[model samples]
Target: MNLTTTTRQRWAWAFYDWANSAFITTVMVAFFPIFFRKYWANGLPSEDITLHLGTANALASVSIMLLAPFLGTVADQGGIKKPMMAAFVTLGVCATLGLTLVGESQWQWAMFAFVLAVVGFLGANIFYDSLLVDVAEEKDFNRVSALGYALGYLGGGLLFAVCVLLTLKPEWFGLVDKTAAVRWAFGITAAWWALFSIPLWLWVRERAPAQAVRPSLPVLLRQSVGQLRDTFRHIRQLRVVWLFLLAYWFYIDGVDTVILMSVDYGKALGFADDSLITALLITQFIAFPAALVFGWVGNQWGAKRGILAGLAGYVLITIMASRMENAQEFYLLAGSVGLVQGGVQALSRSLYASLIPAEQAAEFFGFYNMLGKFAAVLGPLLVGWVGVLTGSPRLGLLAVLLLFGLGAWLLWKVPRD
Candidate 1:
């Protein structure tokens, strides 16, 4: 295997981030929630829309959590991560395309489509992340991971900016109306996702397992179970890995929830969707360079310190967000989030990669993502429940600070690998 980094393969791997991020920003973050509230769930209370969003995210995470470990194990064992990645990518792209079919007063279908897209998005990402070991040497993990996220920020942000324009002023694009523009945005997302993914499929070569053998389904299942058991035992033995995951499970929960729920939170507080989109667009652009800078920070200060720095910023941001009284403050908070979000996440991925056994990258990352998805389940439910019960979105936003604080403290104690 070539240990030297190939620029072409590196970029190819990074482009997957570019591919899927459009769906995340445009469909998940920018427009879909607003569309759901105004169209599909029309006349429903704002709280109800929040509940539905939380429920959808939780359900998708639950589904992925249940299936991820087994699938990742099989892929690792069989040297089939790329094929599995292709399958999930196809699933996600199709589901995203399906969003074009959803119409006004069709919240059920919208929910169903969103769930499928999340499932595909998350499932593909597990394999994608695991491939980091395949594409780069151990020392390059931080930079490469950060590069992937940086490109994701750029790609997602660009598409989101265009989508926001189309939705806010369709006439600029010669569209008939905002509804048509929104639907076309879905098409753009699907196309962008598919187009960028081609580079990875064609260029980046997946690292093959040592021995490749075709096994019957029953045998594969048995092997997967045994592998899962051994991995769990190994994790228990590696106290740092276990502790790191526990810490990550907490911090990323806060991060992901903020990403998914921020627009809704801002909107509920009377901020315009256009302003929210513009603010977050700025976030994506800021995050692009910020992620790369964090990679350098991790190298200079250690991944733990870099992560701690980002989490500290998060704690301050979340607290300030809870007390913000106007849109300008919200925009400022959004920029802060951009500066740290990708950096924290990328550094965490590289840190975890360094801790795990490289041979079982796929299976290990599956558990990592499983814990991540499970955290998603809790974070949203926590924020949503508190928001509904307290009738104060500010209080709900405030509750997330606990997660960042706890995660940072736990992370500080971890020894450098």
Candidate 2:
């Protein structure tokens, strides 16, 4: 590829972050829980709604957790990462669009669509993340990885701001009410996701596998299964890789849980929907710059130290969350979260990329995303069940401290690159 083409490929690859983050910010982190509570699952007890939302998140994550590694092997063998990503993006877009059709008090159908959307969103990430190596050299990992996340925060936040406006001033958009505006927001988000994703499909190209002749489907499946077995053994033999994965599994659980549940938790504490949405917007915009700053931090101080610093911030954030009262306090916490959220995530990806064999990036990232999804499974459930059992969302939020503390301890043990 020529210089222009290479540059386009790298930018196109990063733009996928801009594409998918709309769903994560506008729907998953902001609107879904609010809509689920007020509209879809109306008349249900608060705790019951929290449990149901948690179940949906856990179910979606479990599905991806089980399939990520296997699918990674198949994609690596077939050299079909882009094709697989297209399939999942289609799934996610359609499912998100489907949400607009779910009428009032149809929480079951809403849950169904939400689960499938989550699956599509996460399933696509396995391929998306693996492409990082294809787009940039190892020396550029921190900078390029952080660039993608920065775009994500900006892109996701911009759309979310529009959505918030739609909800707050439905008359300005010619909508019937706030609910209609929210439904329209869902449809718009789907379109944004589909539209922004086209650049990646057209510009970025995956490196072909070594095999010249393409294997038949049956042969590919057999090879994939065998490769997966070998990959498992490879992970076991790679001490730093496995150790880092263990640490990622723990800390990212807390991160994912907070992102997924913060709006709901705020609502549970009696904050208004407007306040919650504003807080999310705060995080997104703040994280946009913070992610870039952390990229520099990773390059200068090392990814390990950058990640460890982020984890310490998270520990403090979690403790503050447990004691938060009023919207002002919630906003403070949201700003705090933004400062470290993208830094931790971007550094983690770059850090892991440095540790792993780039030849089998997809296969190893499978395990990376697998552990991520699995950690997600534990987090929402922990918060949900703890709330259900203790009848205090505060206590459930505090339980996340354990994950951050343990993860930080383990990460400290990993040798610096």
TM-score for each of the candidates: 0.97, 0.99
Please give the lDDT score for candidate 1: 0.89
Residue-level lDDT tens digits of model 2 in 135-205: 88899999999999999999999999999999999999889999999999999999999999999999898
Residue by residue across 91-198, what tens digits does model 1's lDDT show?
989998898999889999999999999999999999999988878887899999999999999999999988887888999889999899999999899899999999
Worst 10 residues of 2 by lDDT: 205-214
Off by over 4 Å in 1: 1-5
lDDT of each: 0.89, 0.94
